[model samples]
Target: MSLHKDHVVRWNGISLGLGGGVWGGSVCVRLLGWTQLNDLEIVLLLALFVITPLALPFVFFQNKGPLFSKWTALVVFLQPLAAFLGGASFFLPAGPLAATFAAGWGGFTGLLALLGLVQLCQMRRRHRLSLTELCLAGALLYLPAGGAWMVLACWGLQPLGFGVHTDLLTAVHFHVIPLAALVITGLTGQALHNRPATRRGVCWAAYRIAAIGVLIDPLLVAAGMTGAQITSLPDLDTVPADLLALSLILLTLLGLRFVVPTTVSRVAQVLLTLSYLTVFFTMLVAGTYVLGVTTGAWTITIAQMIAIHGLENALLFGCCGLIGWRLRTGQESQRSRRGEPCAY
Candidate 1:
């Protein structure tokens, strides 16, 4: 029952590979057009994206404890089952059955989020939680809450008749937000692991500003959903995107400064560097889009935004980030075995 570090690393690799495959499959489906996909194909593709990222935190927190370890293992094993049920529900003739499957997926995701929160809390209790941990923790908290909302929407439980597009909300919740969180988590971990010599105060300030934006952007979205004053949502969203862009630029510079080209493979180094760049680009595009939306200066549609920020960001930087982390983990393990000083 002992979950070794190598096993955890292997699991991470598997998750990354599966996630990449899902992304590739999604791209093919998109190119072929949505109508071209069969019911099972559609369901399976959606399930792959939803289910794969759920196992990421486990890769980082594998050594936590037996209970935590066992839970992580169980979650990984349950991914296929969740995917099958969730996908099959789409083709089900019975609305209630479809709702049941959606609810089951929600519950499963909620459990994953709860586990992540528990790990974050434990880290906090030990006074070991960093800004990166805090950010990831916040993302984890959002997953379940977002999932629950999506579930209600799926069940057609439109509270207060807000005219919410349940399917759209579900797609955004599972696809964009969680995936963004996962990429951010990976980036933060890389930054921390490298211990880049950036001013801590500057980093913290930038993070705070970015975090504020992330926290409020969704609220603004919800407010817009309720037909509240959305006149300022775009402007408000720009603040975080701008701050995030600056923060990432700083982090990337710091990472490049200390990266040992001699020790790390060319591919891993490229991925690590690209991860930072992709996130930076994402923030920039997001900010520009928001400003355009607010001022009527741009014609970027929501669909385009999702493709750039969601699919592109996740598939490009997200996968690369995970791969870089895997490489870094291997290096650290080698150092440990050799009784050498580990940089991380």
Candidate 2:
């Protein structure tokens, strides 16, 4: 990593390598009960643990202000929290998140709103923010914000504590939040194209509309609307399926980046899409078991997949940054040709 004149410390090989070790060690300890322990080891382990998750920011985003850094740190830490919350659903008894239906759902709705606000604030450039920019910011915010809520959902902690079941967590948080976030994303997108926001408006509107289908499908299944419960292996078929839906939301969020204005931006988009696609693919494969395709010693559930998708969604901001960079470059080139300062 390079230390610049501004005291901006960028990511380097050592940090990344050490971060990997931290991640691998933690996973090993949790899963296999494997350890070569000591006092120093424990201290090093604790330090490394935090470093690994936080390193992505160091690698991706360099120097910044204190508030932004703090927020980034919080978001980074929340990655593991998402898993804790979603996983807790399986381990805990289920019920409404709040004591009253309206209260709990409303609380969730509000938290999501605040999350969006924070995103909007962070997603600006030096100048000239556009509709596409807002959407890119919205997509990025979906991950950490959604993960924070999901973890709380999994913890069975609701403002109203309505006593809903864990089975409803994925649909409630994963489905509903994005359905809300994408509304703005679509709006921002339409506004960017200067086309009166019709397509963006409709696309986002369609997400909410489609969510009705998602919510209704499960209830229908309960009422025998579709399958006759010829049960299979994934035992928790719903989890994987829900996770797939979550993954799809994430993957689709970055789709526009594929047409980003530069070769590097296009490549980044492709790679990001691929990363998210892998998460989705794994979810689908595991979902097959969740849906009862076959038996295996290890199985992937929809919840696990959803956790992966959350992180993938959070990375959209990076793609957005690239988009802004490209537009600036294009603007500068035209300005040079026309004997003027870059303006678009």
**Best lDDT goes to which candidate?**
1
TM-score, predicted candidate 2 vs. hidden true structure: 0.36
How does each model score on TM-score?
Answer: 0.73, 0.36
Q: How accurate is candidate 2 locally (lDDT)?
A: 0.38
Tell me, by TM-score, which candidate is best: 1
Q: Which 10 successive residues of model 2 have the least lDDT summed? A: 39-48
Model 2 lDDT per residue over 1-344, tens place: 22332222223233334444654565466556554332222222222233223323422243254544554444343434332233323323434432232233334334434545655665554455544444433433343333444344444565334332332343333333333223323432332343333335655455444334333333333333113233432334454355435534443443343223222334444543443344345445545554453545566554454344332332332223323333433454577799974222
Compared with the true structure, all predictions reach lDDT values of 0.55, 0.38
Q: What tens digits encode model 1's per-residue C-alpha lDDT throughout 245-273?
A: 55555545444554434235567778777
For model 1, the local distance difference test gives: 0.55
What shift in Å separates residue 111 of candidate 1 from its native position after superposition? Answer: 0.7
> Once all C-alphas are superposed, what RMSD does model 1 give against the true structure?
4.7
